[model samples]
Target: MEASKIRLTVPEGIDPSRVLGAGDGVLRALENLVRAHVVARGDSVAVSGDPDEVELVARFFEHAFREADAGRTLSADDVSRCLAVLRDGEHDASSLRDDVLLSYRGRVIRPKTLGQKRYVDAIRSSTITFGLGPAGTGKTYLAMALAVAALKRHEVGRLILTRPVVEAGENLGFLPGTLEEKIDPYMRPLYDALFDMMDRERTDELMERGVIEIAPLAYMRGRTLSDAFVVLDEAQNTTPEQMKMFLTRLGFNSKFVITGDLSQRDLVGRRGGLADVEKILGRVDDVAFSHLERADVVRHALVGRIVEAYDAYDDVREQRSRDRKESR
Candidate 1:
């Protein structure tokens, strides 16, 4: 079979150098576009192979960067919509627009930040989604939002939230009270997200009704979850075996959102479950993995900066430790 070609028309009045950069620039852009089956660059950018892919890419460039020289600032929403068009193979823009506009529980769930939108879409389409990144990047919050949205739309019967209860090297056995009580602190972030989406009284009511269930990662073993939206928060603390077990527990009619900050793993000397999942299933079809970087963070402005700072700090520490070990 012959490889199809795509001709991309660079708009006039816009500096190709600036837009495409020098050497390898145009190739990189075309590579991204082609991933969506849009176009392949040659003497001139042309769309071949799939007719729908060609038109979609053409429309995306036209709508997104057509007026670049006019000093038009592309908002985050614009970027999100364009990406959604590419990610979803559907030719109809109306459905993408409608999904983007759809509100959950009177709160407009539009993907204002690029990562948030990607995470939401992944959660909706894939049976399993891995949201990995630093803190304050909406990794857990966005997953909770999607889970809540699914529950509200009756796509799932209940919401199950779980996380490893490892904190400050404290063993779960040493903690006072029952299993739930011991794990509540570690799972507080998940609870906080629920409270934000649902009213305090209503959230409590649901908890009492068992419509919303929170548990430690240990309790997730030996069970099959069906007709539920399960979220594993702070998954970076889970060992590789635990992560595998949790993922395989998904029964029929169930979806999972696993969120974690790799740098914050509490399990010393043990690999993070979330990281292991990404490594093992990155290329698996029907599984979506979205990464939230520091830029996509929309919390307090300082939060984004803080995440970046910690990332830099960790990088430096790792490098120094490696150097010292080599020297020894």
Candidate 2:
């Protein structure tokens, strides 16, 4: 057996002594990043077994050397931190694709951002997943994508999408039309995401055939969903009891993805189901939760900034509320 070797191309203006810091410490840290790569040719590093791992090692040295040439001091600990990030795929450009791509309808659907990837993975791996984040972060979109993929793969018999029918500031009873027509506006976001993943005509056909079902959270009670992918979008508006009822409906082989923006809950009362679920089920092992920050917003660039602005406002408002209570 022979030990693997990694060839390093010391670029001009970067002193090798600076990288090593006049000792073997930096060399050892670099060795950990190299793991199993072998020098196949000058300036090229190769590793047997996994191409992904080899590329990871190659990228670390590339970034490390660039920092060294810029007169930035590189300690062994810094090198270790860089390797850790790379190993976690933070620096890998294709990390999002590797995590979220699913082949469906003869096309590949990949999440546009890291938040979307985490949301999809959580839905797949856990019996229940909560995608809590600001608007435009793909929480609803990825959940719909997962539901479509599950149906396409025959892993589930049907797809059920629902949301609370809470009106922001209006009375739903005053709205004309049948129950379904009145509630359609609230469920539009869920429908839009579904339409994007599946052809509109085909989606219409499925809805008519009951293969795909969309309704309000009120309709989910007294039912057990077996072999189904159930997504509750905009769930923050659900009352705590409603949220509990939905979770209990998870039957054999069914997966549930519940997505909401806590700050936007329209439930009026302080006991929204989405918030309660986060507090109660957050510690459960088989349930996964992904909280997306403004950085994970993958919509229009402006949307990310808007999310951040709202977050800052909310933080200030919350602090003021706390201060008022304490003063009393």
The model with the greatest lDDT is: 2
- TM for candidate 1 is 0.67
**What does candidate 1's lDDT look like per residue over 1-328, in tens digits?**
4544556666666654433335534335554644344433432355565555555666656553443554543443344445455556553332333233233256644454555666777888899998888787777777777777778788888899998878787877899999768777887887777877787887888889988898888888999999999999888888889989999999999998888888786788876777667667989997889988786776777987888887899899999999999999
lDDT, residue 139, candidate 2 = 85
State the RMSD for candidate 2.
Answer: 10.5
TM-score of 2: 0.71
Per-residue lDDT tens digits for candidate 2, residues 74-145, read 666555545555676744424344433353355566664555666666787899998998887878877787
Off by over 4 Å in 1: 1-107, 169-176, 321-328
TM-score of each model, in listed order: 0.67, 0.71
C-alpha local distance difference test of each model: 0.71, 0.74
